[model samples]
Target chain A: MEKIKIEICVGTTCFVMGASSIQALEFEIPEDLIGKIEVTESRCMEFCKDHKDGHHKGPFVKINGEVMADATYDKVLDKVRAIIKKKEEN
Target chain B: MKEELFIEIGSAYTNKAGQDICGDTIHFKKIEDEMRTITVLSDGLGSGVKANILANMTSHMALKFVESNMDLLRSSEVMMDALPICQIRKISYSTFTIVDSNINGKTKIIEMDNPPFVFIRNQKEQVIKNRTLTSPKWSERSLHISQITTLLDDRIIFFSDGITQAGIGTKKYPLGWRREGCKKFTLSLIKKHPNISAHDLANEIIEEAKRKEPNNISGDDMSCAVVYFRKPRKLLLLSGPPYDMNKDKEYAEMVSLYQGKTAICGGTTANIIERELCLDCEIDKTSFDKKIPCASIMEGVDLVTEGILTLTEVYRLLKHNIELKNDNAATRLTKLLINSDNIDFVIGTQINNAHQDPNLPVELEIRRNIIKKIVRILKENYLKEITIKYI
Candidate 1:
């Protein structure tokens, strides 16, 4: 199976907002998804500013290049689960 | 949460004339004791020396008043009273942009009759809450001031009228590069070079304004400044050799464990790092950058320089009274220091017999004293994060 890449922002803002806990996410991964997922820590995604089209989101996690703003442990987990299920079905 | 360590400032300016005079004045002061940083950019009523003095005084007064914790509106009112106004124009002699940022990341920006400052976040425009303050005096001027807690990667970009007036009469755009154009251009630049230092970003904006004109001459003095916030950048500097010969691996191990950039000073120290880390230290003597000894390269180390000469030069540069830019090992080290939010000095206490030899042409201050002085200048003078460790 192809690996699923997740980039978590640990820059000052995100870290303060609790992205620091994202690093510990890897240790808690379920057995089924252990090797199938790859988690990386980025110092800063540098996206604290609002976009020209919309507002900026914080505590972001990028899964396969898609940004999930205001990330949470359960929210991100559900996102990964859904994506994995879709990939399996295909 | 602990306060963010320090803020980095970058400024660039182009005068209305190719000559020595510029009507715009920009000044920045960091007060470590008070835990506040004040920056002011003032544009005088008109161009030339007369305007220069007015703008200079305005910036100076603004910093003094704001740093003392005066209410900004009250302080600005007093400031307008102090400066002479142009009676015909019915405006104060200077229009200003003032930024007051505290250690806690709370920032207040006050602007009077200039282009609206651009504050960006997450690759989009931040909608700042601006309140209006009208001058009570006969002067009919109005100001916009906003207060917001800044986040990492948040940028405050302000510029003089030269940018607002660029390409006004040119066939390209009779309206010139207005605030909207400026914002769009900045957003594009920020998108392309997200990690650019404030200095480079400011210069890019000023240059873009110059390009808008076919004849390439700005109608007024143009200046731009950027304030960027980020997580503290940590640098570990290893110099000299450990007092205990046995701790050579320990020093190398510390560098190996450091997450930030690493700088190795002295040939012997470089050899120590090379030996412990099992990496090759190669000296590139090809460059004719004659100002100092040629720098070296080693795996896992960001910068490598000869001991005394380079350290002495870096100390002098850190103690440098004037603000200027240069390309050398010392300057490179300074750039790294300026860019970093904090620096850790890992000192080796060994005293070299050769450096003590009177026959040598160089003057060497005790390495500890040099490091201490560098730390003082960084903390007290530049208000940067710095600490020292002796081995």
Candidate 2:
């Protein structure tokens, strides 16, 4: 199966804004999703620091090119599941 | 249970007999009668036999002095003078950090020039608070005395550069354990096995550090003195004005006399303080917690930044005090500052028109306030009587 790419921002700004937990997202995803999702740790996507909607919408994790805010465990998990399900359908 | 304080020490170094004959030595003694636990960590120059001798000698000398009930300055001086200097090396120095307090469950730390000690409680690590202790005759290098009383159940960690130098993750710098990694590692251990012994815990940390380093460098001989108290330690705070050149000259000369440990924070300031103090210093970019103005003087150790040098010594002093620990936190912080016998009279300086508030820039001020809260808590619980002199 083609892996659904997941990128995590490990920059200072993201790191300070709870990216510490984002770094652990790979482990939080279920075992079956591990094969479907490729969690890539990146050094400063730079875009995470770009202000959006008048808020510091950073510390983000991009799943299959879809950007998500407050990229917490549950939220990221949901995104990972939807991507995997869609990949299976395709 | 006997309800008596018991201490078991396990020390190893590069010496001939797996003993620290002349390296950094941490001495712990429990005075059951006084309910006081005396813990001392002293760092001598170099490693191996000679260093072992110096460190061992320091520990012994400090023990004798403390046991004799002599004043802290007198004790440190006696130990410094007693060191056997090598004719060829021409340098045999040792820095000290000592804690003495009654067990009514109160713990006070009397620190000279040693690395900042950390206390672990509720699985979180916090550096012990200290103040500057000065003696006129020995105040070069700023002989400082810091007394801190803390509640028991808090585990106080005293280490030489050896432990801190343990590399971790990709960044191969000492103090590189990366607070989060170290914190997580420590917390995980306790959480996994609540009954783990302190000895085991210490070994785990050392082993982990060794494993993470690429060269598997045993690194410097590692040693840590950890005191796990069951209750809060009492405290006394004492501080005086910043360094007064007129009066500080003698103190500076005194610090010059002893071989003590020195820690410098921020990049550029570490360079200058190392040169001025004639002591080996390690600079850490990620070391200082960004909350307060950076503290330049810790225990007997001085911290400075590039900005301070350009601005002026007085500005550095004011900015530093404001940033690192707040003016009010001086109470408990005085306990940690008493690391050097040479540090006397804190000389605080800053350029300010009466009309202007000398507080740091807004962002830096926020950091300062966070540090302030921590310092305030330390002062409320421990420390007393530290003076501030603005130049």
Candidate 3:
């Protein structure tokens, strides 16, 4: 199976708004999902700028182009696991 | 068109042993509009507070007079007449050396009782002719004036009598480190570190002079200044992401084509460069500071740090003129900023929405305001030329 791409926004706005905590997603990935996913950091994905007045906010994380705004460690983990599970089933 | 040489002026001084203040003063002014620089080193008659006052006054007046383009001889005569005579010594005395140089042009040096200035080219001392001028009213005092067309890699060093008269009665040399001794030492130093900066050279000369005294305690108020003519060191500091996402490529191209040291101060900005330039960005985990974020490494960039927070720390450090003892991102950035002669700041105008919250600490100031403060400090305090552009 092709690896899932996870890009975390570490921009100034995202980092201060809890992107730093979300950065831990790199290490907290479950052992079964480690090799199946690739994690990277993006300086700024500009999601905060795009969704200024929307329900979405930052720290933002993207899983295969799906942005998770106002992201947290557990939220990212759950999303990553769900994606991996779906990938396996498909 | 001829390229203007960057005149790096550096001075260092040590007070007389057990004295709270140095009796020697070095003053420098850069006339940006005229593309000229004037540096003056003054040594008063004696050590302690009285000497400090005399030296300060002489240097201040000398700089002002030279800036006004007054006649050097007449200026000296006026200075001599205005100085107050010491009650105990029955003489008002201060020695001064004034260096007026036009960038990419001729340099004029006027020396009084202070030691003759050392002129070096290609690490070798060059002989220059001097014209002596005297005022009949003060017949005993004479001034030596010299003019030379400065070239790249040339250096002019001047100092107070303290440097020459160190260790007057020492067992090693009763004569002390005279003019020849100082010259020889400077030449040897230049030979070792051919591209030594003016700041380090001045500091090393002062340290060596102090070592000549007993127990490394200077016998008099020692001072040394070096004027080095050389190419300017440039640095490009990129911070924040551009407001228009389409301009990210242009921002990265600026970093790719910059002809000097480069630093990235924002995570988002670094990401854009990394993506656009196809460069790898890796976090250096060990460099993390409690307050500032850890720095990253990117190919061809001198420094990569998280924005806003790191910049704020840099501002504090530069403002306080603090000595850096930590290997954190902020200190590293500050070191690079200070070492460069010319700095170009590319500030991304994109606002970070998180910073807009009022509850956030006031120290997390808007990025533009912080950068403006840093630019002012760099210019006024460190004498660095700064150019800023908002993308």
Interface RMSD in Å per candidate, to 1 decimal?
20.5, 12.4, 3.0
* Clashes per model (N, Cα, C within 3 A): 9, 101, 1
Interface RMSD of 3: 3.0
Predicted candidate 1 versus true structure: per-residue lDDT over B1-391, tens digit per residue: 7645457777888888654688898888887676677788999878888778889989999889877878777877888888887767866668899988876779999998778899998878888989998766635788898997987788889998888889888877799888888889999988998877776788899999998866788778898888877666789998888999899999999988998998987667887888899988675433213445446778888988766666777778778744546566666777777667678988998876534535433456778888888888877655577788999
Give TM-score, chain B, model 1: 0.87
What's model 2's TM-score?
A: 0.42
Model 3's chain B TM-score? Answer: 0.94
Kindly list the per-residue Cα lDDT of model 2 for residues B136-165, writing each as its tens digit.
Answer: 655554454544455534566666666555
Residue pairs with colliding backbones in model 1 are A47-B122, A48-B121, A48-B122, A49-B121, A49-B122, A50-B121, A50-B124, A51-B123, A51-B124
* lDDT score at residue B61, model 3, on the 0-100 scale: 96
lDDT of 3 at B112: 96
Model 2: residues >4 Å from true position, as ranges? A1-90, B1-22, B86-89, B136-140, B168-171, B174-184, B230-391
Q: In candidate 3, what are the lDDT values of residues B44-160, reduced to their tens digit?
A: 988899999999999999999999999888998899888999999998899999999999679999999999999999888998999999998899999999999999989999999
Candidate 2 lDDT for residue B167: 66
Worst 10 residues of 3 chain B by lDDT: B354-363
What TM-score does chain A of model 2 get? 0.77
